[model samples]
Target: MDTEMYIEKDIYVECLNDIGMLEIENDEFFMSPYIRGQRVIHKVLPMHIMQTIFYYTLTLGEFNCNEESVLKTWDSRNEDRFSLEMVCKRWCSIIKASCRSLVLSLNNLEANTFRITHFTYLKKLEIINNVNNDSDYSDYDTSDDEDTKDYSNNDLYYDYFDQRKNITYRRRKRVPNKNSDKLARCLSTTIQLSLPNLSTLNLSMSNLKERHIETIKSALASNKNIKKINLDGCPIGDQGVVFLSEILESNNTIRQLDLQSCGSINGLEYLGRAISNNNTLEKLIWSYNQSNYTSVICLSNGLRNNHSQIKSLILRACDIEGWGALSLSDTLAINKSLRELDLGSNQLGDAGAIALASKINSHPSLSILDLSSNLISTEGIDKILLSIQSNKTLTNLNLSRNQLDLSIPLENLTSSLELNKNLISLNLSECDLQNFHFKQISIALQSNKKLKKLNLSKNNFTIIEPFITIIQSNKNLKSIYISKHKFKSNELFILLNHIFKLNDSIKLDNGEVVNIDIPSIVHQLEYIDLSQSHDPLTKNIILLLREFRKVNNITKIKI
Candidate 1:
């Protein structure tokens, strides 16, 4: 039998070779040849049957169908595994068994009813109702008069509850009741059966109620492995938050919690108390959730204690003014574990910025700081830059969307940055920078060789000579964004000429450059963005792109 099977395999290979359908080299390993053959074999085989065979062979060690394989099969945004399942029953079985996450938007009733039975092993389920009215639930019934009458009103809820209870009992050996019907069954089943190894739970965009919080608390009461939970944009307010706080106070495994846009300040305060003594919690991101100064004060006061373990704090758009920001900065200065702080889009003015910069200068571990969209002007920026000069651990800084003007002395700030060798990524976009500022930046770039990415877009700079000089000298720069800045015709030409001369590809914004030629040294270029640039010579742009493609073997061109 073995001899016959080997002969059949060889015959198959020979037939494929004759038809130019397979390209397998004998010098490679057995698995490599099989993988190569799979590509061609799948083309001839129906998708459903092919998936079944693929999984079966993989389980038998005759092929590879690991996590990467499953991801490749089901990672399409436009198409789901249903298409593959529709091709054959074999595929449907394999996909139903192997799928770990199922996202079903309950927009259509027929599709929801059809697929509900297949979610036996779904570890993560996202159900979104996009219908305009609750009456849309009536469309799923196509039964006898008696059955229709039974499912017409609140009976619909009872039927769904029963179905959920059955699924839960089948998977978890526990029958779900009315109290645990809505979100509890889903969470319980996910925790007990489907997601036994689940460590992260992201319940974003769910309309969770108070009872749902109790369900989650009950689920996490025994779970000791969950490390992260993101409840962003959920309608879990203060009461639900108190329940979550109790859970956090008890569970020590959760390290990162993202409650952004979820609860209010009072809820946050309660949560702070619950996890205040936790030594394992590292990152807490609670940005843009209508947190007031009282909440910030409460959090700041909580962090002042020795038991707090928060290392990174993000409080963007949290209604924090100068006093609140100053208080937070003071707290951060004292906190030893905090390394990154994001206070972007807040009401932190120059006083708040200066206060934070002072704290940052004294901070021993803080490295990355994002203070964008604050009301800080040139003076505030100068103060921050001066503090950066003294700060050794800080590396990445974002100062975008402030009212910084070219009148600010860039030479001093550049000199300070040069002294501080740890800076890597600098964002100075929309700071009203012009030619003189660019000249200063060029000098700084020539001196600072450690910087990798620079964003100077949306500024008032029209002359490109200084920027070109910086690009030519700054060999360490990997990416540069200079979008939305208008340039003169000569200036644009000069900029393109210098960029084409460089070995590293540069990203350009929308602007006109007449008769640009594809440079000979184009192989080193990786990306080019010429979107929204309506040049008079627009017809020749395609030829220019083709020439670039021919010279550099470009893989991506955005025009």
Candidate 2:
């Protein structure tokens, strides 16, 4: 044991000497606490950016904007736009020189910009209004435009998913606009002076009825760097649209324009003329103007000769009809750039459907086609389905609420889907489905793998619920809405509880085996609605989901 211990001590001394941990001076050993040439932990900052951020954090106070406090500051500054550089003078100077965005609207524009000259890095400037969104709405009676549906942060769970498609995805929110025309007109020149390096400008109108449209015309004409502009819920009248038409005719750098829910305007004819001729724009989203046939025809004429840069065109619920659809079809046959087109709830009938189908072979860029609520019959459905067999670009097709006969159209649909193979999502809710239809769809799904979503709501499922027992599994169903259907208790139990395997391997703290059948990781159903089903089945479904949520991270389960 002594010899072994002496050998171990000799090895430890050798290792320490090799690592420079044992200082050798005159044959006497001295142990160093820390190894030489080792890097010390960085105490203050490793990178230059960390030091700069730390300095700014210590200098600048928290950015809190209470209405009364901000208004008080605004009044105190006598409308001089308070320097957004709220840090120390050094940090403020750095940010003023480097900041790419400067937003000044309402009373915030009171700051004079004559003292500053070199704002070369500024890129995006937004000037809306000063109305307190949360407090003002509750106290004052607002219009429908102010009451715009806020679907922000909420999951996309709408039958009408495209309602907020255009501007909602822009990472910007709705700011209440004021009808104070005097304030708007006064701020027009201030808009020009502040936006020197601006690339995108958002001007949400205060009151659609009384918003100063002249300010928009002035701002659009004055800026050269503004490439994108969003005018959400702007109540643009005939005169306002005429001004926009003139500005769009001359503007070359502007690429994206969103005038969603701008129906308060009556002059779509002018806007259509401008849209036809503009070559710089890549995306145009215009909705709720309720234009008539003349305006629709004019818009079609504009798109026919458009340069291939235009990629997306969304015009939803614009009261377009058969003639309107026919005109747009003529343009689609030739237009090369348009990829996404939404014409839902336009009442485009058999003639419109035929015109659109004939052009799909010519235009391969057309991917998303929404013809829901267009009064299309079996003949129209057959025409559209036949187009898919020849064309390969189509992905999402919504033909919901068109009163299609499931018995007649189901055969053609499955065959076309088999041939197409690329279509991902299809909505066929309220189509008067049958038992045989469900059975055939199950058989079709056995072979097809690309088709994902199937919305079977408002179908005659009570009569046909038993037939879907053959549907053993669907791996890609992201969402399924089966509310208001009389599903049998056994059918519900089998479909939900029995399809998935539970983890019986789990045990209790008391060393007992806990075996309760609930959701495990083997389920793929992300969203399901069993609301208003048979009472006994609904109770079981609820109990199952209460435990299901505990186990799985399902997004939503509607009761």
Candidate 3:
């Protein structure tokens, strides 16, 4: 034992001398402790000991300060892990295995020299493409260079994968200009090369062209794990859509595809064909496109196909007029799988509303419908209410920003609301409703036990007494929006006071109610939006929120 200790001491001494720790001024490497210009404890740490220190004492591992605060520190902790990995290659390997998400900026693509394929555990990959650099990928730049050609066999266009390390290292070759197509193609190869766990690929606003789309399609063709692809705001026009259609036709793993504002009108037929051919895709958000009458008809034909299983379709701001809506309505009538349809910000007037009203009554599965910003007046509303009076499936209906206020009141709709049991949320904001309309609505909703959310904002109502009645009567009412009102502070206070004291009861010893504090009725009120109210009213609501937050589960009061 004595000989072993002597040998160990000699080895330690040799290591210290080798590392220059035995020098008089060794501040160049080792941070040796000193007192009055004299060194103390000039021992050298072995490599294993340094690794042990780095893994435990130096590494930012699981922060177990508290369970509740663990989630709050996740983002900061993740960023710190990336920075800490640069300390050594061992740390980089260890840290890369645990990283589950990565955001790579396209502007700094050339600067990313490190291999990201080491992140085998990554589930989400977001490529942040700047909108300002969209011109870099424009067709107008006719610079005939070698880089512009198809680089299927080129090493410079592809990132080499290190099979031993399970990493795809970016090449050192830097293009003279920002050729997004080349960069995008390289990224596609990288995506296909590694990241077996990647499920979501967000390439929104990437300005992807036809070739880029084709490369992406090839890369993701066999990747059955990917469930969602968001290519929103990318100008993948007709030909690009054709490539995407091919992908959709063969790929059964994808469930949601967002091609919003991708700039395609004629290619919608191809998208429609894909939609009909694909059996797995469920949700499609194709908003802000020039979907005129003929194009919409083409799209609608696909939607009504027996093979189409799309559940949610959003066509907001698609320039859809009466004829376009008529085509969609016809499709909606036959497509029983569709549950949510958003046709807001379109030119669908009363004719379109009437057309949809005729079909939605018989539709079996639709539950959420948005017809806001359409020029539908009382006649359309009357027809809709009449149609939905017996319909049992429709729950949420949005009719905001329309001309619902005419000289004649919607008496039929007001009366129909009292009998409709399926409707839960009704948004009538900016519908030009007056006190009489409010009175009728309040009276109508008195018997409604299922309606939970009600939005009556932007109508500029003078009297909120009708709404008070609503709060007093409905026990299931949870959220109410009554913003932009000409209501007094005291009136608002009374309404909120009633909401807070709702459903609570007190009884005398003999079972006789002494002072009834019952919700003027029973309720589980959660949200109230009184925004755009008087300043004093706003302040009072804030104070009220603070008070209610201390005891009740009232989540929010938007003022």
Say which candidate scores most in TM-score: 3
Over 1-559, each residue of candidate 1 has an lDDT whose tens digit, in order, gives 1212131345656767898887655655464433455556567778766665647543544455456455322222335444444334555566666666555443322234444445455444444433333221234443445432443345343433356556421111222233223444455444544344446666674455556778768767566766777778766777877887787777788888887887566765776676566667788888877777777777887677787788888888887789988888889767887888898998898889888878877788888899999988887888888888778788899999998755556446667657777878888888887777778777777777677767877787667667666655666666676776666544554455455542233333355434433342222224433333424323334444455556655334343
When summed lDDT is taken over every stretch of 10 residues in candidate 2, the lowest stretch is 33-42
Question: What local distance difference test score does each model get?
Answer: 0.64, 0.61, 0.72
**Candidate number achieving the greatest lDDT relative to the actual structure:** 3
Candidate 2 on 322-403: residue-level lDDT in tens?
A: 8888988888987888888888877798788878888875577888888888888777877887788777787888877777
RMSD of each: 12.1, 17.8, 12.3
**In angstroms, how far off is 260's CA in candidate 3?**
1.4
Q: After superposition, how far is residue 191 of candidate 2 from its true place, in Å?
A: 4.7
Instruction: Give lDDT: candidate 2, residue 316.
Output: 77
Model 1 TM: 0.69
**Candidate 1 at 422: error in angstroms?**
2.2
Candidate 1 pairs with clashing backbones? none
Task: Sort the candidates on TM-score, descending order.
Answer: 3, 1, 2
